[model samples]
Target: MTYDLGVDLGTTFVAAAVARPNQAEMFTLGDRSVVTPSVVYRADDGELISGDAANRRAVSNPERVVREFKRRLGDPTPVMLAGTEYTVSDLIGAVLGDVLRKVTETEGEPPSRVVLTHPANWGPFRRGLLEEVPGMVGLTDVGLITEPEGAAAHYASSRRLTDGELVAVYDLGGGTFDATVLRSGPAGVEILGMPEGIERLGGIDFDEAILSHVNVVGGGALDALDRRDPQAAVALDRLRQDCVLAKESLSRDTETVIPVFLPGRQFEVRLTRSEFEDMIKVPIESSITALTRALASAQVTPADLSGVLLVGGSSRIPLVARMVSEALGRPTVVDTHPKYAVALGAAVVARAQRGEQALTQRRTDTAAEGGKDADSPARGKTDGSTRSRRWPVPVAAVVVLAAIVGVVLAVPHIVDSGPGSGDQTAAALAPISNTPPLASAPIPTAGSPLPAGATPGFAAVSPNGRLLYVANGDAKELNVLDTTTNTKLATVPIPAGPPQFLTFSPDGGRLYVSIFDVSGAGSEIAVLDTSTNQVLGQVPVAGQPYRPAVTADGRGLIVPVHNPESVWTIDTVSLKVTGQTPVPPDPSWVELSPDGRKAYVVNRGANLITVLDPASGKITGQVPVGAAPNAVAVNPRQPLLAVVNFNGNSVTLLDAGTDTVTTTIPVGQHPQAVAWAADGQFLYVVNDGDNTVSTIDPRTGKITATVPTAQTPTSISVLPDGTRAYVTNLTSGTLTSLNLTG
Candidate 1:
């Protein structure tokens, strides 16, 4: 027999199915059912046991029995059973091998090919183990599909769904909760969004809650009963079993009696559905929150969803169903067995591979056919149908051809333009020379005036090259410097506390300041009007707002909240929060694209930049940066992104269009801040530990110069005309202005 198998090797359950020659005749092993509990045991003689046999041995030999082995797949720790040490991969292999043997025995032949289902968040290490399991089971060629994707494909195929249909899959399993949003079509299923839950949570948590309740009701006697008398211990064990039964029963009933037995005495404790709901409310609420976030990420409302499918046995809980329904405002579809859906879907996918069904072609053909039918009536009903329709066909074909030609012609221009495209004239400017003149004069810092009591943090020059704002943490203010005169003009008081970072509005009329607050009490952002040189307003933000940026239109300000997983968006006009978008942890800096449509937030903790659509509040993509991206600067004239890595001591240049790191330019020690020249001629980076400024030509992405500065130079910026630059030194408490014209 040529069997194509799909395996769902879950933490608490293992399921496998085989697609027959006839696609509709897919058969599941074990009485033709799709699921089996994932239980394993090792005998004293080192023989492996699984499924019913292992489950039967669980109570008698708890030490040697292993359940939920999938959870430990990524851990380096090994499990010792019956004096034999086995890794998580080995344990999983045992379960998978057992299932493979059953399929072979049931079909009276070995399976030809297999596909494995995995969680979306599985890393390379975990994926490696998953791939290894199929090999161990003697399946040489194996494919992998995410659990959610498998379930989504199943739903889409069963209903003959088309592409662009958004669906949410909420999987509450034995050890983890995963939520995913997918768009199904003829091109297959594309994952639009995915959010993970606590790995420590699941049905086991509910069981533990019940066990805890049993102990509480039995009082201290439950502990004594286990140790003092053998008969009492057995009776106490029975109570634990009864608690589990009652918990499952409460899902379909309003109340259940959990019986506790000790020696010759027996007592009954009643549990209401309300009490059970209350017990697991936090977890259920968390699941709802994850689902909400998944929808938000996909930029869809509950009304836009086709449906919400519940998968995994834990999703059978009454509270889980209720919470999902309430949050999504749609009835939960639990028609398919939660534990078997993924495996069944995978089996269906396997049949598609065997040419029994065309999964990808189904939706595409339907859409095209539907479009043709819709257009037929329009062409026939029009007054000048013959000529008008004929003209439209040629015109549309010409317009499409012209558009393709336009894109091909503009490729070079787009490559030269930065993300901002803010300065069209900059692209026409002559290329600057990288090699300084042999007789180049030293930068005139001899008469530079240092601000008193100012410990500089970061600095930036206005777009028009008139003023430079330096974050002076020790003085608790921003020292405004006159760029032309190389002198301090005024110290603007920052009531939001100590200034840590600064960015100017596109029009250069406002300055946005972020303050570092470590007490966890909270942080505040102070907006100052550049013309008035006075504080306009202060808005409270969660954690310390580490870095700040202003949108190109000056309509919004983005701030990174360090602790909590969010970025704060404030309306520049109203000076109020428009929204807050959750991000990866420890977002230390942010930068907006030139068009003001997208925002890039640097997640220091995750070592990646989350690209967000500010208008839709959705993360469009993520780009991996160097270790600890302390600062990010985007060139407006081109699709260039420069990130300074403090620990890695290098600047990573990313081609935003391709989302790939083009080059890594090694810089001085501890690069802290990065900025692009107004004309996009050069990229400047400040090295805090080395007290130097590294200059690179963006076209070549090579460091052309390393200009030494005052002690501990923390920030650097260039003038709009590209004739001068500014550096803030924290230890020396000074802002040094460099003459770049020479």
Candidate 2:
């Protein structure tokens, strides 16, 4: 006997099913996990590893591992692994081939026909890429369907849908989100309108948040690790697994304990479901927004839709059900096996194509009062009324529900505008120039007892922008990297106290590092000659300094001395302090104007930016800002000063020329530091509490992007080009790089 094969290739996970007789059997590969993570890792010896092994190897070999690749399908650029580039299709093919191998091992032969499913919002280029995969893997005859359509087919098989009845499909997977509305008719299932989808928000994002939480509050043992260490891989993999289990457990329970194990020390973290919901609230709200847009485009209200099918493994999160119900004013429809629903739908079609009897003893969900239906197969058998209806060929999610009496509907009227309804041609066909390659390094000082930026190394770009220097705290070393190759050029060892701040000369010829003691003593600046990549000399300062700013002419460096409450200006030529300007009780960071004429220092104790004339040790002006002002930034081209208020969770915009307050803009939780983008058009603020980098428009005072970082991001530096940025995560000890263009 021959069985039909179906493949469900997901961004975060992969699954396959074999259909025979009346039921679909999940094909397992090596492990019992019916779903395999779509990850590939390049082993130390050049071995290509996939699935669980790849995941297991990621902690130690992060740079060599590639996942979440499906999101970049049809992109002109390929993935780089172990110094080698791989096309998008090549990565996907690896997963498909592994699934096929499982099929051959379990079924004893290749399937006669195969059905494939992907997101409904994918455009022509992505679809074209997917279509080519089947042929590459030796699958002769392949039928393709959108994920939403496949899920609808699975639901339609068991539940009878009346002609013209419409159902909404909400599929939230690991890497993306999609919402579709489908209708059943005499011809079969057809899409009512354009599908709704969010490309970036997904389950994986939630996982990352939880992972960051682990790093921040999980205790001393858990910190960013160097992939070169074998334990690093094992530790990270364990943490991820624990997070997944904890997340899954929260679906049924109110709280779960996550176990974090290090070599000698281990700890258990108890997390509440409510807390998790809060962490992922943004994405949930986004999905709800997309859902409403899809409903509007479909011209179908919550009351008009027959069923709201919740598809994808991530839908199991209790928050999804609550949010969808609250927003739609009705409970969502779910299958007992929501994770496997889409694959099941494609599997049934595959079986039917193999000439097997389509009738099955399947669970049929009935439209009920609360909008919730049975998810288990024990509920009921397939309805004979919709048995003749088959999945349509051209694709969209298919769905059917019994309508009241006879309502003759000629055709689906779909609206042309809304989110995800645009001509998706730009999605895959065009090269995504904004997407940039990123590199990360473990801040050896992460989780150290020292304060935020002081312990976590901060990055600075040389004047010429050719090199990026990252000063580490506990490691007591400076990591010099080549920007062009994203490779480490050298590690310059410095005296032991964790570095709080550093600055490059205007010409990028010299580097100045402010090293501070954890106990708030022994403050000094180590001057490094960029040419030789060595510390030239150490200039003793009166007190601990956090962040230092360089003057435009490259002649002086303004250092904010914290404890002693003084700002010191050092002459570049003499390599000695010109003078110390006495300031408020505690100065945190300093910013200098373009002309090297003025200095703006954020005084933590004074709640103001104490302005000083660099020419002499004198106070020029003081701009009162929010309480606990931590850092300050200046726009060279404009007379704008941005002050990050730590406790206020906002940024106070000050007019440098008039020394007057201009605007008070709200920011993320516990804003710690601020920097002006090269153009002065935008400002980047590091939010330590939320582990996010908030990009704000200086003119409108509105946040543009809240890019998530590892944990406790303390310091951020951007190149003059504004295309690249580096953030130091204090607790996580991970130096994160970002592509500013996006």
Candidate 3:
């Protein structure tokens, strides 16, 4: 057979289609079905089984099966089957190969041309990983197409699209949501602007939401089901499958019953379509907001769009279509088989590729069009032929420094820049202290601003350096201080327990407060809206969460926890725990390299630092530091990391690039916290035992200044302009402002 083929390797399902003269025909990969489960199982014989066979085998040997490997592409972490490790590419290649084998068997030959569809918001890194799949499947000269472009192509294949007409695509898939706008051009449908995506918002989230509702209605019976029981896992699996069926049944029917099977109990819960709609309303609204932002980024109004095209399995919900139409006030078109739309559309693109014509134009490398993070610096323009661009560090630093200088004085500032597409180093202004300006500089203290018996623990500054948030552990609240005046602006009450640690979003729009486990009520992370300082919601953790680090992408949080000896990954979009990675004991703090690819965790009990990939939570390497490592920080401008040793009274410096110990420098007694200066020239160590802050020149490995602070200075927050630093004292319940510009 000499047909062109398109394959959609989705998170939950896989679909394939072939292009004929004027139409695309879907391939039946399942028993009388057009799609197959995207799952793979490693049998005892070491042979890989996929689709329905794998799905069935997983019931008894769940440990050997892998699902949703599509979402883990680009992650260096590998999935372990029994004793063997399988890379994400290997798993995807297996499923893709299965699809290819079936299609080839039916047609009596392999397809001449093959095309694969991926999420529109995928940067070059992920796209590059997907580009390797075809070669592994014994296919050559394969093409790649964005999912939205494929859907738009399939839509245009049946209907005539006028030139310059704009159409929007709202793709809510199993694991992610992508919102993109495209325009009809001479060549094909071209993306108009940067696509907006919610990486954790999709059908899987809705399924979780429904499962949560089940737990609530079942009087927490599901929660009480002991997972340690051998039958519990299988019961829960079947319950989840029932939930998926119930969710789908409600799409056409008004109500459905979900059968719940626990270890010792079995029951059915009635669910109405209205209840299901209510459960998913908020996330659907979030998707609509993404669509609106995409249109705004394209500089076009909703009225200018020819119509809104809905694709993906999740987009078939009636409520989704209704909300899209109401939100944009435009006609919405839902595909008859939304799940297979991307696959069919890929066939269209594949046929065009076979003719030496690129149906869709690649986006130019620019600030708005290319796949750059929102905080990334502007990139040079391209001719819309290439898919990648190199991001220079100096150029990024110039842009980041300019933004910081515009907000603060014309002084060096450490702006925590987000990670760019691929291998783009985050830009931060280095503190150029060629001359040690201060020797034994003293700081003024803001004596106990709160009521008596209040213990302040941790502190952080906003990105703009306008506000400082102080966690009052004893008071069970967060004290907001105006940095200009060094006075209290407001106090926001903590929800569940005393606030233990505090961190802010990169944009300063939200603040995350880790709450202690009070009276065995369990711990949680309280989320607050910075604009109003009001508690928005809370994400429950399995154990007491220590200091959490927000990922460079700003879409997830890496939380180090105690009691269970694991780190949790929280998707910021849904405020839900997505994954857990086990680590050494007593993980206290987490720090990310400026580039954000690696996360460094300080294991206080183990006296070592564990380095892991932030995306996959897979441990990459480890560095042994001084005794009782309490805190860690990465230099903004250099490839250096500083780890504070509480018991050893020293700071261990490591090379962030190689994860190797560079040197160790002596400091004051009980150095509990460490921070890099704005220009990356100085290191600040907060000594809890000595109640002093030691300023060390890392280049010389000598203390430049030792300034007295409030009693038991436990945390430090340096201002963005490198002019001052604030130290929070736990015993004195006050803040000491140190002058660094002298």
Residue 371 in model 2: lDDT: 31
Candidate 1 to truth, TM: 0.52
Ranking by lDDT: 3, 2, 1
Every model's Cα RMSD, please?
Answer: 21.2, 21.5, 17.9
Pairs with backbone N, CA or C atoms under 3 Å apart (clashes), candidate 3 = 430-679, 431-679, 431-680
TM-score, predicted candidate 3 vs. hidden true structure: 0.56
Q: lDDT of each prediction vs. the true structure?
A: 0.65, 0.68, 0.73
Which of the two, 2 or 3, has more lDDT? 3
- 285-330: candidate 1 lDDT, tens digit per residue: 5455444335544556778766677877788887777777886787
Residue 356, model 1: lDDT of 20
Q: Name the Cα RMSD for model 3.
A: 17.9
Q: State how far residue 258 of model 1 sits from its true place (Å).
A: 2.5
Tens digits of per-residue lDDT, candidate 3, 148-206, equal: 76677677777776667777677777876665556655544445544434445567778
Clashing pairs in 2: 59-233, 60-233, 149-397, 161-400, 161-401, 162-401, 443-733, 463-508
Give the lDDT of residue 241 in candidate 2. 73
Kindly give the stretch of ten consecutive residues in candidate 3 with the minimal lDDT sum: 393-402
Q: Tell me the tens digit of each residue's lDDT in model 2 across 1-742.
A: 6778778888888888888777776777537577889898887776667888787767666778888998777455668998988887888877888888878877788877688887665544466678898777777667776777668777877777778776767787787666566767665665664543545556777887788788778553556566566676677777887888888888899998888876656777888998898888755764564454466545677787665788888888988888778877765787778778888788877765444222222213233333343343221121211122245322233321111001111111222222222121111111111212211111101111212223455777654344566777887766665443244445566764666578877666667888877776677888876666656788887678768888777777888886677888788778788887778877888777777777888888879888888778689888799979998888855888899999999999988779899999989999987877655667888999998888887766777667778878888877554445678876776677665533
Which stretches of model 3 miss by more than 4 angstroms? 357-742
lDDT of 2 at 443: 13
User: TM-score per candidate, in order?
Assistant: 0.52, 0.50, 0.56
